[model samples]
Target chain A: MATGNSEVVNNAKALSIEVDKMSKLRVIHYINQFYAGIGGEEKADIKPEIREGFVGPGMALNTAFKDEAEIVATVICGDSYFNENIDEVKAEIIEMIKPYNADIFVAGPAFNAGRYGVACGAMCKEVQEVLDMPAVTAMYEENPGADMYKKFVYTVATGNSAATMRKAVPALSQLVLKLAKNEVIGTPEEDGYLARGIRKNIFEEKIGAERAVEMLVKKLKGEAFVTEYPMPAFDKVVPGKAIKDLSKARIALVTSGGVVPKGNPDRIASSSAQNYGRYDISTVHDLTSETYETAHGGYDPVYCNADSDRVLPVDILREKEKAGEIGELYKYFYTTTGNGTSVKNSLAFAREFTKELIADGVDAVILTST
Target chain B: MVKGIEESGIPVVHICTVVPISLTVGANRIVPAIAIPHPLGDPNLSKAEEYKVRKRIVDKALHALTVEVTEQTVFEN
Candidate 1:
């Protein structure tokens, strides 16, 4: 529940999209605390709130809903608060949503503000995954969360500011009804959302390599063909100063080779991995077939499964640790399968676990790939 | 993973069989290895020989961590 002391922001502007008839289907909307009439950055640490009925931009959304559905509840969280304390906030929001039993969830047309966009994306993705319900969010095509969640959720494309709310409402409302009614979802062009880059498997006239070259030709000519993976602008990394002493530095092993304790208890994918696993190796001196195996599918797993040390070199590093050639090996190793995994997911996994590495005082890392 | 860890100011050496792929993905320090399936081990050899091969590759990766490279550079093994 938003406090009465909250001050309304830019959401009071008139939007043209409207409908007179009340709808039956219930919808839950998500917006940042600022849009809930909470103050700006200075007050961005406010926690989650469930306000009964529409607030701010949810008004325009309600107009769009018209005869199909109505905004039953609005969930608001500060952008910073949502991003900084995601795990806790996510669980809290899920609990808040359970009582409403809303048919569909809609997050912000977040525009170009990065944190809000990511929050909207994260909320929509979580709703779909954990609640097993349809969810949608709108944001600028270039929003950081666009590439990260576009494949996992439906995201309507919007302009770079709240001014586009009018145009955004109809498309978002339309998607809400479509999802609520269990209607067929269309291509991005037809539905007014960003492309998900999900390729359908259909027998083509040409082989893949030949078709790839053909796509290259079409791309050069600016002809019509579905676009392929676009490389994101990679961060320019400043090289860390060389480790000054081998005997004293804490060395850690991280891998994209996907070596795990036998049976891979986490069920991490053998290819196109969606998650990473951290395993404790405090007592592990040698990797054996009975104790470890490879989950990577892009290469022969036999060698790695026979001796997981092949991919991780744990046996050698263990020896190095004992001989005082290097400092102690970090107790946990992070691993994932690199096969067909998206760069966006890879970047996310790294961003998450690297924090743990730094917090644990690991001085250096050795990353291996198959 | 290599570049991400490095960006956080922890030096990382990427050990992989494909040096070119490592270069393309922006690992500052790289170490070449044996093959895709067995980056540091050779099943064709005896246990002692295979261990020596693994140790050599691991030693090079550790060495790569201590070398200051101005750009993406691979330390061959």
Candidate 2:
């Protein structure tokens, strides 16, 4: 009886251990040809291939994750191949990763290697977007791909070269664990990751006014003070190919000046608008005082209300169309109140409406803002 | 919003009173407005004068859209 009772106790302990092992988070690591033990740049054209278990820096990541997670597989591709055939390679790599059913995807601590950095960023982005999996990577701050993809992927900042691999691996692994376990991630300074440029609201012990006063005092004392909201580095777009001829162009009117029909029927907020309004002005040639007004609160409404065409010049655009200076006006106009609106919200609004503008074959836009 | 439209491969001319702000925001093509309160026209001017002012600004914006620029550019009225 005593022997039987001991056996039963041992079985229960074994079962608990098995349960714990099963719960270890599954991870898949991605690396370029060099790290995959393939030949150097010569092998960079090699196609993507998957291998079971850890490879290269992934071994360090495995150690960092320790018993909390296990790298189930490694997906290796050459930098040149990945970049040169981005769409195809991404699809193939995603397929390879899918079978693993990984909880997290980790790409290279790419360092300053531009091609490798791009590969890492691209893979991580694809995994996050397509597979709906948590993806993380490491790269130097100046890597061009870092600027392009950091907003979409969580990237840990590493030294300019692989000499920092020792440091990068642990930081990358820690972030992976936090994401896999759904743990709260701290600020970029605390988490050793690049800022994703996403603004999140958090409650504070003191009001904003008090914080501002404290910061002012510190500044007056010539002490260093950090701003709560750092200004964004705006993206500079190279101008698109110029319209060959204005007479043949179909121009569309868009505005952030908050000019809407007199009734403000869309109820777009006078400030910090959550959405944009699309109004059809196909039949209207001029914006008269009784027909249109300014919905914007930032600027005085008097002038714009007197002649809404001053804000959105449907009147002049019509004259241009009549004079054959331009092909025609697009039948509709898009308007939103830009004052105090978050960039994210603004982008979302544009993304949604631009599709329709594109589909309608609009050639150019005249975006007026106060 | 201007950036988004430009990024979609459509050329955009941002007409604003604040040229510096427009430049800082990375607008590729810009036309300066007369003032913040009345971007396209001076309200104090007579109706016909205001119409000419508005016409000139619109013409500049139209010209801006056609001119090929590789970088941020502000068109002089």
Q: Name the best candidate (by DockQ).
A: 1
List fnat per candidate, in order: 0.72, 0.68
Off by more than 4 A, model 1: A1-234
Query: How good is chain A of candidate 1, measured by TM-score?
Result: 0.54
Give per-residue CA lDDT, model 2, range A1-370, as digits (tens). 9999999999999998899779999999999999988867557668999999999888889999988999999999987577657789999999999988889999998886656777899899999999999999999886656776899999999987777889888788899999999999998999999999988898999999999999999999999999998898657876877888999998899998899999899998976688899999999999989999988864567888989988898988999999999998999999998665656777788878888989988899998886
**lDDT string, candidate 1, A1-370, tens digits:** 1543232322222122222323378899999977888866545558999999999999998988776788899999987577657779988999999898889999998875556777888899999989987899998876666756788889999986677888888898898899988898887889999988775665768888998999999989999987455665566688888988999989889999999999998989976689999999999999999999988764657789889999998899899999999998999999998865666788789889999999998989999987
lDDT of each: 0.83, 0.85
Model 2 vs. true fold: TM: 0.53
What is candidate 1's TM-score against the reference?
A: 0.50
For model 2 chain A, give the 10-residue run with minimal summed lDDT: A338-347
Interface RMSD, per-candidate values to 1 decimal: 8.2, 9.3
Off by over 4 Å in 2: A1-20, A235-370, B1-67, B70-77
Candidate 2 per-residue lDDT, tens place, B8-46, comes to 898889998656457655689999887655678787899
